[model samples]
Target: MDDRRELPRKLAHEHLARGDATGWFEALYAEADGKEQVVPWADMQINPHFAAWLAAHPRPEAAKRALVIGCGLGDDAEALAAVGFQVVAFDVSPTAVAWCRDRFPASTVQYAVADLLKLPEDWIGRFELVLEIYTVQVLPVELRRQAFERMAQAVAADGTLLVIARGRDATDEPCNMPWPLLHDELKFIETCGLREVSFEDFLDQECPPVRRFRAEYRRPATITSAKS
Candidate 1:
């Protein structure tokens, strides 16, 4: 297994780079529909920064239900379970969902094949915690905003949302496919009504240059209890 930390940037970003158009996803996923190695979610692991952040930001005791967007092979979802969250992760590709289920058969993680932008309306407001990692970047610019809105709508009131994604600096290279979010672009998520909790940057430049923006946002707690 190639450690995600050691893969070339092109390898890690291949699917997104190849899937640049709004309709490119269907074809990409279709090609991978039944393949096993097509989606290597397990290969993408939590780095020291993410692990440390998870250490301090405990999953809410009341938040037993969680939804993970674009969960590859359930690595992060498994991490969530280890922290007492009941997780349901979804990916656009059936290959990814199948890979995730097989990867964690004995674990409590659940995965489905679904398109994020066209998710069922009932899914809205259903999750106490929604985890978005690298999905928005895969989308075309025209669709990213709408996809982000859907992600925001999934969070339950008094719940939390966490995003782990590649970010660009002012001097970053031009990106088309797998377009990394610029600082201002990320700030746009704030308009969705999620209160910003904290944001941190994780920089790893071993083989595949890894620079991540790990952000936390919370849905408002109206009751204002001691826990609040």
Candidate 2:
């Protein structure tokens, strides 16, 4: 583990001990006190796999609205904006959201503080592209399925939802912070009415070569309905 991850792990344990699953995020961000390095996953750049995915896909101007879940530091959201997306990126921590706004003072992206577990009603089926990276795995196992359901429900008709996360086998023990996801858990996205367009399970170019899963899904448009 990167020594930087230790603080969050400690914070999580403390919060979870108090039966607070989500509060740890705000605590972690607040503890960082504007220092990005204190947050383990703040890479400060668009994720390479995500960049490659964007490059491979069609850049249709018609599909413009995008949403990013748990967008710490806003790198992915900024990348989407650069590619012409009208983006909404959110984190559970207000401190993190403030950090993003301060880092990109002129950004058009709407960086808000919102909990994924309790999404707003207007957000359901509202986005043309949804990006979720490394957010769900940080949640407790009991909440993972619901988190996935919220993500799928946010996709507009015929829109895309791209998910990137640490991969794990069904038999593997998820005994750490950012608990990796099983293949079956990943398939829960499909259960929420999206069709899988592509799926990749590979070892990333990290220092120790971490395994990653990148999956693309799209909600089907039945042809009789409006974009609504």
Candidate 3:
């Protein structure tokens, strides 16, 4: 396998040297979309933890619905489906959606092209399980809070929201590209009323060790409205 460990940091270094990480994302995606290049979720290493987590949590077998945000190619969605969850995976790029559909023709998964930040109100609270793997951090820091709230609102009252994100130690340099999550960033979800049930950090040994957080949040079963 092509080593993924050094690539992200290398890209970040390039972006930092250029002093335009955000611009780099924009330019890269623009070229990718232009060339109709559909990036695959498998390319992101979504399996190792996600697959094991899904295996451990099984979704009760009766819970059928799932929503995956920013599903580039569909490997993770397919993994969920293989475990009996009917998944609706959505990405903003039409090229990515088309690529997923073509790649998984016989798979019991649906792929759609939609902006995650602007999901329709009708879709709110509709999923039994929501998978957000590294998507929130991709947004600029200014929009990160609002983006997380939107993601939390999409989960049903009793559903689970699975988050897998890259992180860095508080003392580490504030670099870009795969922007690491900060402590206050984690609090934004709590401010939106979602409760964190479990959290674990995965650390890998390499030249620049990889640090990531896997967390699960759930909406409360009961909430009193002002009118109630």
* Model 3 residue pairs with clashes: none
* Tens-place lDDT digits, model 3, residues 43-117: 633457788788787465584788999886778999888878889898876766776787789988888878777
Question: After aligning candidate 2 to the native by TM-score, how far in Å is the CA of 127 from where it should be?
Answer: 0.5
Q: Report how far off residue 1 is in candidate 2 (Å).
A: 5.1
Using lDDT as the yardstick, the better of models 2 and 3 is 2
Ranking by TM-score: 2, 3, 1
Global CA lDDT of candidate 1, please? 0.71
lDDT of 2 by residue, 1-228 (tens): 469988999999998889899999999999999888898998899999999999998776674789999999999999999888899999999999999999999998989889899988889999999999999889988899999999999999989999999998977765689899887898989999999999999999989898899999999985786686
Candidate 1 per-residue lDDT, tens place, 16-123, comes to 456544344344435556553543333456545456767887566764788988876668888888898888888876766776776678988778877788876878
* TM-score to true structure, per model: 0.77, 0.95, 0.79
By lDDT rank, best first, the candidates go 2, 3, 1
Q: How much lDDT does each candidate structure score?
A: 0.71, 0.91, 0.73
TM-score of 1: 0.77
Where does candidate 2 stray beyond 4 Å?
225-228
Q: After superposition, how far is residue 173 of candidate 3 from its true place, in Å?
A: 0.6
Worst 10 residues of 1 by lDDT: 3-12
Highest lDDT scorer: 2
